[model samples]
Target: MATPNELTAMRRAIAISAQGLGTTSPNPPVGCVILDRDGVPVGEGYHLRKGDHHAEVNALTAAGERAEGGTAVVTLEPCNHHGRTPPCRQALIDAKVSRVLMAVMDPTSRGEGGAVVLEQAGIEIERGVLEQEALLVLGPWLHSLSTGRPHITWAYGVDTDEGHSNQALTELRRRHDLVIRRDGTIEEGVPGGHGADSFRVPLPALGDEPGKALHVLTESGARTVLIEGRSNEAARLLADAVDRVIIDVPGTRPSFSLTGPGAESAVPGGFCLSDVKPSGYRVRLTAERVTQDQ
Candidate 1:
């Protein structure tokens, strides 16, 4: 086990690695911590991109010979399988690492416990350090990996000074950047039903749909869709036809193929939507109820 200071250092290392996630695509985010002989941290790293140094390798390079007797703490297990780079398990062994601490186990079936790999190599291993915090950061990506889809996270900003209602408007507007805008034709999943201009509703009301159709309408090109946990029943109903799924809200994991009429959705109250500059074939939405939470 690492000392309190070493543990704190490990967390800082993970936070730095989290920033790399935004820029790294087609690869899962990872964080690593290298401790000195005395179990103090010497170096740290996170996965930053495809075809680049992995977190374990980067940390090993930074620690050099010092890694020979050091323990490595990581947010995710050292991957034993290969893809763009060599297996991280081999890198740690070559570095002469003596021990490993992992917060979360890799869910990939081929990624059988990194702790087991290190232990077989004669290094000490322990699992689950700061598990909850690590899971929260890793939740969406891990969920995506397990389900073969993209993770969806809703960002809501709100002002505390004013009442909750007024604050919601400001927050919704800022988070709209994460979504693409839809314009022109919006397709209904039902066959043989042509789209009608008169059928269009203000973008925000779409959120009231069983699946909160605002994001779904704009995501015209998405082959697989993951709806937030707060999405309406309409969105839930679309799940089976959609390529994949992700639920962001707490409680209840949804597993439906489609939404029936008059069903209720989980979209939060007070969300209103407006049109954005639609480019190409997409619908744009600006939320009326989002305030930046300071």
Candidate 2:
């Protein structure tokens, strides 16, 4: 239970901790902040690598003797179980920290709640301060843990009409907002997972018209796309772009607003009749047609 002023300090601590997550394979991005008794920030930290000092420890060390009798604010609860190093809970206690404020609890099976461990040590502990923001920062890491492979969430505007195109991908790269996230694997529940495999950089930028030759090249790499039978030209363009294309053509006349990649429905004419859906409803060009166009 930190005071209002102390809570603000805690938020900043978590923000700082998030900065340390760079190129650290298989490790979540983490951040931490340390406050002297007066609630003045003396240090901050972010996780550097797999077996390095966690954000909390780095912040504490940055605080040095100032950490004694002071408070520690961290993004993730200080880990109470050991892996590459001893539990952070013991480190905080040994450092003589008088109070601890945490954002989110760790999800790893090896993770033991840090707040519980700290409270048992007789140190004051506060939990759930700015938890949502903390979780958002840790989303990639958590997703990797849960799905066994990289987590995929299509994003952007609030409508189904929005999609990637040759020019758009290029523009995104120029703007630098679009990033390809991949984690090889986390645990053995599945297989061949290593954790954050690699990131694809400089995704092709969108052209002036949004549809371009480069976008066609990118479509070749996609697993699937969401489409409605209404836009045949768009569908065919997309179909030629990706390895597999999923176009929605209603058997009878009923529509649903549910849209997004991988949404489940019992709708008929889904992935049915490559010829009709692709050339007629989705795309009109077959290999011969495309050859003629060439």
lDDT of 1 at 238: 45
Off by over 4 Å in 2: 109-112, 153-294
Every candidate's CA RMSD: 14.3, 14.6
> What is the model-wide C-alpha lDDT for candidate 2?
0.53
lDDT against the true structure, per candidate, is: 0.54, 0.53
lDDT of 1 at 101: 82
Candidate 1: lDDT over CA atoms? 0.54
The positional error of residue 51 in candidate 2, measured at the CA in angstroms, is 1.8
lDDT of 2 by residue, 1-294 (tens): 568866787667656654543333355667888888787888888875567788888888899999888888887778878777778888899989899888777876354477787898899988887888787566545654563433222212212333333343333322111223222111121112112223222244333332473343233221112222223233343333322222222222156564543222311222222232231222221111122333
Candidate 2: give its CA RMSD in angstroms.
14.6
Candidate 1 — which residues are off by over 4 angstroms?
109-112, 155-178, 182-294
TM-score of each: 0.57, 0.54
lDDT, model 1, position 261: 28
